[model samples]
Target: MSAYRPEFEAALRLFARASEAMKARGFPAPILVGGGAVELYSNSAVTTGDFDIVTPRQEEFEGELKQLGFTKPVGLGHTPLGWVHPELRLGFEIVSATVLNGMADRDRLVLIDLGEDGEVAIISVEDMIADRMGQYASGTAPEMLEQARQLFILHGDADLDYMDRRIRHESGGDYGVADLKA
Candidate 1:
């Protein structure tokens, strides 16, 4: 009776496995980011076909993924860093070597316990909303605005002040969390 959708649960399981392997290998755990964080914070109202993760130790992280039965498909036009677990049929990309390009507050990262599946680190809801706003401000996609709005509306417990500062930083003061409230 897990509340999570199948896709999200699978992603979490895979992330936990990879993270555990990385820890065993003496590497920093990966930070789940992008659409995966959105899906988690949005209660699956927002869904992504793949997960995006950030880790300073990409080489070691990929090695751990390999040990966990993930493979980079050959000649499939996938990004060099994209890896898929065939059984799960879901893939993830190592989007960046640094977490949120080093703009994120490491203190704000949340750890989700997956019981025996281990745990995964995710960006804070405040940071995620700001990230979406940043994407919208950068003209990446109009949907990014809607994603920010969705997260804002869903997480009432989110710290407005923190989000405001993060939004200003991410958007270069072009937008703020207050704008999403409007």
Candidate 2:
């Protein structure tokens, strides 16, 4: 069995439950994105307490989570609405769409069966790396450089060419995998 961190496992469970609830109520499932997707793609090598998801219908998605016992917690800073599980500290950052730092629609989503009518949708590994690299390039987050480097070293199969193109395009030729490795 593959090992997952406790925080990720909890978030996956919540995502599964939320997906089922939304489907029953006629809502489309949200695409799992951001750092949580990194954790999932990296097989928990990278972990976060929060799950970031993007969907066309944010209000409906959030409503479903609220109906499923997730509450909007305060002091999370600028996230529109930060929902948390009643018992666990797991947080959800539901957003309108995939933020286009780069690597848009480059790969397919991988679904993980969580058992019982719950399936989790994860962003592609390429896109996940793009997300991290985007953060690194923007100078908003210096630590994302290390995260991108770790992902590059840890996931050998990740497409270096694609990542290089994305980093250059999004950063206006400022950064690349070479920078991460150096």
Candidate 3:
């Protein structure tokens, strides 16, 4: 698994352009939010084939594509990787308050250097665990639980206590260390 890989250096250029576009236009952070954001680090989710850019005040542009709880403008020039730039599109997803809040306080997230190629500034694993909980909170997917368990088993760092607290808070019960693999 090429854990947490996304289109590299070009995305930074695009981000700068997008950020500048937003700033110059008096928009907010113009943050990146969605699977692309998460895949910047974790191997859990991969190339979602789309980019999710969020802004406070949005004006629809032509060629906007809306799906997966997101809206993107239509006919943005494509990258070599064939992914679209959302800023060029009029489509903007109205993201959750939590996501917007997280983007505001970007320092809370973790940054792992993917290389000179590009660094991975991903949401912290703790937040990743918490955020993903919404999908499986209803006991719908056993595989989802397994993925969480695997994440803890392999990359849990030394903060078992912290992981446990998050698990309890989101999962609604303690699986206990016995349930976790050594």
Candidate 4:
């Protein structure tokens, strides 16, 4: 009954399986971040070709991925350390050992229940917007600003005070929560 794209659904299912496997092996579940989080929060208004995750235990996580049939590309042409599932054609990359390089508030992390698929943890909307703002402030891409605006507009109930502090921290005060409205 969910209106999410097939890719998104598949990705979540895969993430759930991986999380369960990791838990069974005594490793903490990986946190979903980057474009995957953006796609999820955007309600498929945006799409990412790959999924990015954060986990302190990279090697163990990769092992779990391999057990899940995600294999590393043979050559250096692809994303280093990224794994690709041949049949699903989905790529997964572990972007960082810590969530938002440890800048994000642990209390703000959102846990989404997938019913039988288990649960997935994602960065809060405030942190995601702040992350985009930080990317824009760094002169990396103007699109990040637009994405932040879209998220702000869509998530009207977002905590502005938290966003303000997070944006200031992420952008080094180059951008603020007010800027997201602009």
Q: Backbone clashes in each candidate structure, one number apiece?
A: 0, 0, 9, 0
Best prediction by lDDT: 1
The lDDT values for all models are 0.88, 0.75, 0.44, 0.86
Give the TM-score ranking, best first: 4, 1, 2, 3
The alpha-carbon deviation from the true structure for residue 82 of candidate 4, after best TM-score superposition, in angstroms, is: 1.1
Model 1, backbone clash pairs (residues 3+ apart or across chains), number:
0
Model 4 stretches with alpha carbons more than 4 Å out: none
Is candidate 1 or 4 superior in lDDT? 1
Model 2 poorest ten-residue lDDT run: 98-107
Task: Give a tens-digit lDDT track for model 3, residues 1-182.
Answer: 24334343345334444445455556554445555454443453434444455545444211122221223233656333222444343222335434534423355555444343333334555545544443356567555455455445556573566555655555566443334563
Evaluated against the true structure, the overall lDDT of model 3 is 0.44
Residue 26 in model 2: shift from native, Å? 4.6
Estimated TM-score per prediction?
A: 0.94, 0.84, 0.50, 0.95
For model 1, residues 1-182, the per-residue Cα lDDT tens digits are: 17669867986887999998898878888999999899998888888877899998888888888888889987767767688888776788889987778988899999998888898999999999999999999987878999999999999999899999999998999999779987
* Model 4 residue 133 CA deviation in Å: 0.6
Provide C-alpha RMSD values for all models, in order. Answer: 1.4, 2.6, 7.7, 1.3
Query: Mind giving the per-residue lDDT tens digits that candidate 2 earns over 69-122?
Result: 888866647354688887778789875465453346525567779887488777
Residue 3 lDDT, candidate 1, scale 0-100: 65
Report the C-alpha lDDT of model 4 over 1-182, residue by residue, as the tens digit: 17678877887788888887788788888999888888889998888878899999889888888888889987657877688887767789999999888989988899888878787788899999999999999997889998899889989999999999999998988889889766
